[model samples]
Target: MAKPQDLPLELLQFYLTAPYPCSYLDNEEARSQVLAPNSPINSHIYSELVRHGFRRSGSFTYRPHCDQCQACVPVRVNVEEFIWRRINRRIFKKNQDLTVHHQRLVFKEEHFQLYLAYQQARHPKGDTDTDSKEQYVHFLIHSPVNSELIEFRLNNQIVMVSVIDYLDDGISSVYTFFDPTQPDRSLGQFNILWQLNLCRTLTLPWLYLGYWIKECRKMNYKIQFQPLEGLIDHQWQPLAFAQE
Candidate 1:
């Protein structure tokens, strides 16, 4: 086994496997391979991999490698050309009363409680019953690369939190949880909007939104963020809604 630091640039390759039981699909199986990047030139390697639609996971990176099904498309927002539409502007105003606290990855009891609430509300019939503090830390706080916890607070109380990975090219949103009781606020949409704003402020050209599946209505919201590019046939192609 090669040490993470010993991996060479030329050895970095994207591999795929046969599809297995899919997490998102009822009868489909998800197949993906480990993306090993040369850690010696970590930042440069990460930047290159991300351009190819690979997402970081701790010290290693990977993307969907499903066979026969190419529904999981990697999407990225071109920050410089992004225009906030009427709905987006309205969301910004709705969340104006909420304060965003960006901080280093830190897990607390309160965060776990909120995580449990989000899972129970959003995925009650799913495998989200495991809501222990250790599980929360392992899932969100344990990371090998630079990561941050963006907490959204209203009335001095934490309502939403997003675990984000800071890659060389752009920010990778690992996961997010919020108080599901406040459905009217639409925290999920607000989180993405906030991330886009952060990227613009930092002058980063892209925001690596993990994957978009056409069949999943829950994931379809990603397409609403216009002027995004989707990885198609190993190339980034501009997705034009007008043509659809």
Candidate 2:
């Protein structure tokens, strides 16, 4: 593993944010090591940052920097050796009807509408459920790297949308939102399966899935893809060893 300081990024600086309530865990607090705002982060610099367990949210690159807990383990899937479980295969089969379209990082009313509905349906109790159009744009559309917006449609109706960043070594699944009404379709799992295929198509070896917390039920889905690796003690290791 290489230190982030050794990366070829010039004038790159990191600062720890004030502790706040943890989003993934209950009754806990969390902090993040955020890259300096307005830092010149391009695809090359971001690729190195991501390799070091950092993730992009809007124009910010950050990683979990909790003081007492190391629950947020950065994880990625090895595309070459990813095991397609029965459930994964079923999910792929189920979403075979969805048509995928790659779009630029421009704002789309249709995408915003779906995103709003998804937030309301999936996370009614969450703060983002009531986000305005400006907030949506700032969160998902604003980027400083080579990012892409992909829409998954079924019969001309938008069903899901994914924001992904293309790194030198692989594709990063930044954020995904789907039609929460069709839970039986398992669009979320299908999204990961689709990303794996996209990685293979691009000849990339990894698919960054961001942080995974075992104690968080929502994040447990990340481990469903077998042979996952997690960043532990600054080293990437198998999920089992990383958890330990």
Candidate 3:
């Protein structure tokens, strides 16, 4: 077992071969990845890896690295410049009744039940299938650095949750789930908007939003946040509606 301190900053090099068809695209193939070991410089390494478009999972950090597909674009919102559009404002007002609480990651029965409900309602066919307590800990509680669970409540009842990883430069939205029964509230959209606001309040400039795959409809919503940047050729490029 590798201790947290044993983890490396720079990924040496890793490889993977897909089992079959890819999830993002129908005709595309999926690939695997591995990383090399550097030093256990958590904060510095995380910042560098993110700027380079890699996402963290457990002790390993990886990028798309898929040869057949370059659709997974890394996205980050410009906190200082983000402007809430009409729809976003509506969502903010809609969810105004909910109260948010932030705390360190800890497994609770209520959270597990909510997570299970969210998985079954939103991603029934997802890999985990059922959101068990052990699975919840593995997925949400397991972290190498500072992490927190942001829970939203309504009338003292838990309704939504977001797993966040804190780094020196920004906050990475590891995962988020909500009571799917409230479709009118658009919890997913609200969660992102809330996170952006939280980042602004904390003076964090970037809010890492995982990947934005143009071919994946589920991921298209990420682009709605204007004044965002995407990683292209190892550089952060501004997203523009009309480009030369």
Candidate 4:
């Protein structure tokens, strides 16, 4: 087998990670086709890679390389034509009191605490040690590409924090965590909408929402935002769905 480094520098090289337990599926293993970290994969390279169905975690870029599954679909919102339905509008209204700020990456104790609470509440069975500040900083704060720590505060209380990457074309949502106790506010959905609004303000064409798994209930939210573009068979296509 050829190592990623052996490939010519003019072209991006990828390495396959050994399969592990699949996080999104039960009784399955998942492998990743990772872009070797040694290359000069800056925001420009990452932006192009995402168009080819790649995504970043920390400084590494990767896509699903599972042998028997193609369930992980890379998706992005058509921010230019994104429509806010009645319920979506209500969600925006529900979060009216929250003030949003787009700032450079910084790890805050408040954000870490909320993230811990969110992980415990939302993913109790997961193996990750979300309580570690080191992992949090490594995941959300450290990045080779241009990124931001978007804060959503309600009544001056830190309710939500979203880490997103900036591409020349649009923004890619890296991760988001909120006060899981306040389920009524729908912080998860609002975060995307907020980014879409930001995309419009910047005149960007898309807002990459990361991987969307049709069989995963938690991931179903990505498709709810209409006119979703999914990378299928190495090409981007519109997912067929009726507007509600």
All candidates: TM-score: 0.87, 0.93, 0.86, 0.93
Q: What is the TM-score (0 to 1) of candidate 4?
A: 0.93
lDDT against the true structure, per candidate, is 0.78, 0.89, 0.79, 0.86
Q: How far does residue 137 in candidate 2 sit from its true spot (Å)? A: 0.8
Error of 3 at 17 (Å): 6.1
Give the per-residue lDDT digits (tens) of candidate 3, residues 1-244.
5554455544335555454567677788766564544435465556667777877665566677777568888999888898878999999999999999998988888888888888888677877744567767877887666778999999999999999877667889889988989899999999999988888889999999998877687887888887878988878888784121
Off by over 4 Å in 4: 1-10, 128-130, 241-244
What TM-score would candidate 1 get against the native?
A: 0.87
For residues 1-244, what per-residue lDDT tens digits would candidate 1 score against the true structure? 9754466546766566666788777898888876634334355566666677777654557778776788888888888787789989888789999998889988677888899888888777876435667667767887666678999999989999998877766777788899998988888998989998898888778888888877787787788787888988989988775124
Q: Give the lDDT ranking, best first.
A: 2, 4, 3, 1
What number of clashing residue pairs does each candidate have, in the order they appear?
4, 0, 4, 0
Model 1, which residues run further than 4 Å from truth?
Answer: 1-9, 13-19, 36-43, 57-60, 128-130, 241-244
Cα error, residue 36 of model 2, in Å, equals 0.6
Better of 1 and 2 by lDDT: 2
Residue 125 alpha-carbon offset, candidate 1, angstroms: 1.1
Q: List, residue by residue over 119-166, the lDDT tens digit for candidate 4.
A: 999888766765689988887889988899999987899999999999
Candidate 3, 236: how far from true, in Å?
Answer: 0.7
